[model samples]
Target: MPHPPVLIAGAGPSGLVLALILLKNGVPVRIIDKERTHRIGSRGAGLHPRTLELYAMLGVLDDILNNAGKIVPTASYDFGELVPKSTMLLLKYHEATPDVPHANTAALNQDRHEEILRAHLAKLSCTVELGAELRSFEQSADSVVARIVKTAEDGTQSEETATFDWLVGTDGAHSVVRKQLGLSFLGETRTETIFALGDIKVEEGLDPNFWHMWNVGPKMILMRPHGVTSTMFNFMLKGRSEHLMNKTLTSDEFAEEFYSLTDRRDVKFGEAAWMSNYRPNIRMVDKMHQGRVFVAGDAAHCHSPAGGQGLNSSVQDSGNLGWKLALVHKGLTPTDLLDTYNEERLRVIAHMLGLTTALLDRNDRGVGEPGKKEFKMHQHGDAMRMLSVNYRGSSIISQAAGAAGAESDPYAEAAGAPVQAAYRAPDAPELVPAGTQGAATRLFEVFSVSAHTVLVFGGDTDARAPVVDALARFPPGIVHAVLLLGQEHAPPSDAPRFGAVFEDRAGHAYRGYGADADALTVVVVRPDGVVGVVASNAEAVEQYFRRILIAV
Candidate 1:
């Protein structure tokens, strides 16, 4: 290998996603988990719209969509009588559009999600080393010396000293890497809200199409079906349910509690698959990284599971850090780029903690959506969906226009909003290829997980040469050039080298990117599917890369 493999301390979704993204960028990784085997259960099941879009970029959306179902409508019950109506917790589903392809959440168990990610990583010749733990580490200027303990199948343990170029802590809340770094995990644990969650089987007369929630006196119980027809469900006991916390893990005790709460003896309880306890920990680390070591996912931030933000946020955290880490490790970009990880993520995480905490508070206050404004809570809004989350104020972002007032709202960018630099790049379909037999494609398909995509609109052969030439100066395979021309103009026969050329016949390419087709407009999409630079000419585009890439 050119450099020592990047050491990832955890093999959860956060770690696995990070390892996969780096592997896609040709960066070596060593993913380890302290657990002896894979975790089984639907611990966190709601995959938000933004998360689905990210999975598409990683080439895993097809498998995820094939296995998961849309968020099931939750059926609320006062004791045993079912409520007249039930609504999606993530809100009403929106039809998939060219700009927002993934408009609804997917209900896939965390266990199965990890399995899909691990299988994809294996295709790249990488596997999660189970039972191997990063016990401790010391970081120098150049490399990280880590002490790892590996447990064999025979229950014997062996310890070894290994060196890695970089270290990332995707480990959970009790992270060894974060503890070793001495970073403060600042904030309070919500003692008022604690719950027992597990995966169990309900082998009787219960509709698997709806998420069942029952309220007994002051306590709350929810049984969310794991899949459409599967007998498995993720059960959660909240509010005044302390009496059943310890007893739910044993024999027929859980069944007795369920019967007592709902007074429904028609349902039979079967063997439990996975079980655990959860408390609302509204907390985040003051800093995400120190020296060459870093923390992400639950280790970096943890909050209530009110809006199903924990798993999605963790995956996004790793995704945000993966591309930046790869660029710096490959010596293609300066280390200054790595600092943006902390800057960008901290802002988003802080806002998210507040949002999730508010949701929990609303649910406790018995505030509902509209007519049922009794306890069926609502109003997480588009922000909770996470598609609008942006880094418009980041130091690395560069733009000639279209982003003057972007920093006011953290979740400002959405499907219909103007394409601003440092925000998640929007998708535009109906781009007809020029002088080729290929069918029409979308901007989402052109975006890469391993390279930056440069979309050039409305520049002629002579004028487009500089932008094309400037991109060519950078290291090959790191930058992709795309030309989006108007429908009236023919394809440039003597044009400079371009990765793809398309005619904006439907005018979506221009409308989606918020650019006119009369002048040269360059929009650079980063490997993580973020717009890095929105410029008018080649000189400005070249300057943006100089800030990101070496020898540009």
Candidate 2:
């Protein structure tokens, strides 16, 4: 029987990332979007450090970084007087360390970010099917048959049916998959407050280096520059209570409000490229999947855009699901592995919803200070970066005999502790191979989303023998092993029997992994860049894989 394709609904960031990941793993996929063209708005523009690391694994970080903007200072104004401390909340972007290379956030409009992902997908010989809407789907014990409607610009519509082994919904809040699954999007809509958002071209004198904000009593207006171009800006206007009634505004009317809020005669506004009157809704389904069908991104959860977690969390949902789906499709693991997707993400999404809701509430009550804004763009603490999010309690993670207890908070780091199972694998620099002269390699470069990476640390050949023997039993391409030798040990001229051998000249990889140089240690990393097990012996390494991977 031919392999059934994985059907993905919606071509937004979540769907595109999922497609790219599955395609990279050589999994057949079919992604469909209802929209006729790509999106153009600056929705969810903040790219946190954790999301950037995932993008690095997906091989699209360079394109995103090159096209994106760095976080800028915030300038606040009250009435006509510039605030004594113009900067909104004294917060500074954290500098990058050896372990955390992407410690700061970057800004790229959602539309452009999706375009980058779409371009990368094209390189894999896959293209998103546009104007194809998922009307409905029916799933059995093993496969899903979906009905899709294709509408043309000339007012013609055609219906077709396709069968796939699995279905994933990455469509926005109004997801047909979730609706058809009868999942309750249980939450409240903040009808008491409403915001107007638009992408508009600003005339000269509006400095693009700073995020400008104006607060006059109950009304607040914010202008944020699009990084690549100084002329374009994302404009947001907030109102509360009776003043927050939903209504559309013309370009001239929006500009009039902008001028009135800023009280700046020198600045002028051009046409509004994209505009929307939105009331924040905080809603999410109880689960992400039912049977062979799954929901992700806004389809699974949605909340106010206060902390800029919507797109980042959505992309992460895809990242968390992509590898497990690929492994199950390849028969490397049982279908039970897929169940963890919902269990792992739902908890994080719940916490995220609460975080964003609290931020929104704070924004509603004006900052106590006259000229200061409490919740400035990029003012969020370390948690907003999402690097600390983990799946320690995941069913698939097999902790070694003496592994440390799971971190209390999913987004909290366990300082001064060994790398715990299910925690993100931190990146380490300056790794020199046996005979590479002075060249070095980084840990992230050795990790692949398509296979499990096993790092064996030992000082000499004898200490590394057991891991080498155990790894040889595994099939090629399914597992990649690297024998990391301490600086004092010299490798043989020939490569190891299985996998590459590198020398930890600077011991950064050793220390970063919290491994003792004298002890023989084995670290098993999952496809999602999470450390699955930290084994003391090679037997523990073999046992851990036995729990997750199918027999060769």
Candidate 3:
């Protein structure tokens, strides 16, 4: 059977990752962006710990970490003088333990993040088609027909109609796909607050280690440094910003406003690289998908960038949908699996918007005021680090015995809760692969992005073949079975024939997953690095996947 390409609208982080995941899974994709050129600006610069873990799975973490900046402390000012560290609007950092490899947040421009994703896509022979806009789309019972407009270098435009198996709209807030689908995007627009933001060159006086901020009730100035030599910054100007948003504020005029706020003569502002205004139009659609057409990222939800959940949630949306779509494309899974993406992300995003909106409200209520003293009330804290985000209540997750998944607490992950089905699988280092002279690897490295990983913990050799056989009933490569043996258990000499066998000599995997070493437990992990099922035996593992994957 021939598979038609999956048409993706928008080339932002969401679209790029979704396209990358699909392409990597041998699913053809056509990713298009309406923009004529690559967008510039440090929009949505905060990258949470969980997003870094996604990047690690995507094989782009090294480049992202190397090129990205650290989350610098906000050198807040009360009237004029610099405030203490305790009072700073800073992002709190945490140490990386064995279970949590990426505990700290990363700072990188949204454009650069997209560029890294594009590079990864290129490795798979997939490139984003810029200036190719999906103007409108219509879906039938099986395929979606799209009208795409392509703009040339000379600015001439040509329209073409194409058909696809699936259409994903990552086209941002004003999505044509969503509009065409007529999905109800209901929410309130914060007309009271507006911010004039710019990416410009700052020649002197601003410290790179500290993000400079000046506090004035209803009026605030925030400048976070970026780019090479730390001379460039993403600056925000607030306070009756209606004039700024309405009037044509030039580079020089914007610079003058910066000087007026900072009252600093030493600092020199260069020409503006990019400028835009934001008022935080918080909104979300009732349904993320309608038939063959689906919406992810900004198209599905919009909110303030206070807690930095917007972009992270958008990327996570792509990951959660991509693999399932790939399975459906490969005819190895029922289309019903696609329903989980909507159900899982909708609640998560709703909770995320609530948190970010509350943060914005707190900032509105004088978190920036001089002598204001509430601990991290204005800062990104341990809460909402996005590490603990889970799909605990999703239909696909199969957990019994009254586990943490039954709690339905969207904030459970932030509380450092115990292991649960549909939770982000914890990472464990020092798992020595059976053979290779005891060379060790992390559990994260073993998980695949294109297949469901079944971890068989502390199982005897006699029970291993049945587990492998049950999983082999599915399409090859759709499922990966790995055996986790404790120190007391000796791996058989023919372990290579069985599958991946990792010896947990230090018992990190067992402790991390909260599984008994003496018990033969099976943990089925989804392609997005989430534990989908924790079963007591191989029969239950196969049964769990049967609810998701169509057996061959």
| CA lDDT, every model vs. true structure | 0.82, 0.81, 0.81
User: TM-scores for all candidates?
Assistant: 0.94, 0.94, 0.94
Q: What are the per-residue Cα lDDT tens digits for candidate 1 across 208-304?
A: 8888877553567788888778998889876534565543355276667677788778778898887666778888998888888989999998998
User: On residues 1-552, what C-alpha lDDT tens digit does candidate 3 reach at each position?
Assistant: 443479999998899989988887889898999988989888888888888888777778899998887877677665444443333547766889888988988889988888888888888888888899998877888888899999998999999998888999999999998999999999999887888887988877777777888767767888888844678899877873344566646888887776667666667778888887788889999999888889999999999888888899999999899999999888888889888888888888888888889988888876634345643576666756888787876777886555454347665552333566777888888888765466788878888788888888765666666776687677778877888877656677547654588888788888888777666788888889888887777787777888887763
The residue ranges of model 2 lying beyond 4 angstroms of the native Cα positions read: 1-4, 82-85, 88-91, 240-244, 370-378, 400-407, 492-495
Query: lDDT tens digits, residues 1-552, model 2?
Result: 553389999999999999998988889898989988887988888998888888888889999999998888778776655442457532357888778898888999888998999999999888988889999999999789999999888868999888899999998899999999999899999876778998988877577888887866578888899963568999888762343346677777787776666667667778888998888999999999889899999999989988788999999999889998998888888888888888788888888898888888877876554334554433676788888888766667875344443334566665546587878888887888776786788888888878889887754567767777788888667788887777766775335564777878888888888777678888898878888888877777888877777873
Q: Where does candidate 2 have its weakest 10-residue lDDT segment?
A: 400-409
Model 3 residue 183 CA deviation in Å: 0.5
Let me know the TM-score candidate 1 reaches against the reference structure.
0.94
Write down the TM-score for model 2: 0.94
Give candidate 1 regions above 4 Å deviation: 1-4, 82-90, 240-242, 245-248, 367-370, 374-376, 400-407, 414-417, 494-496
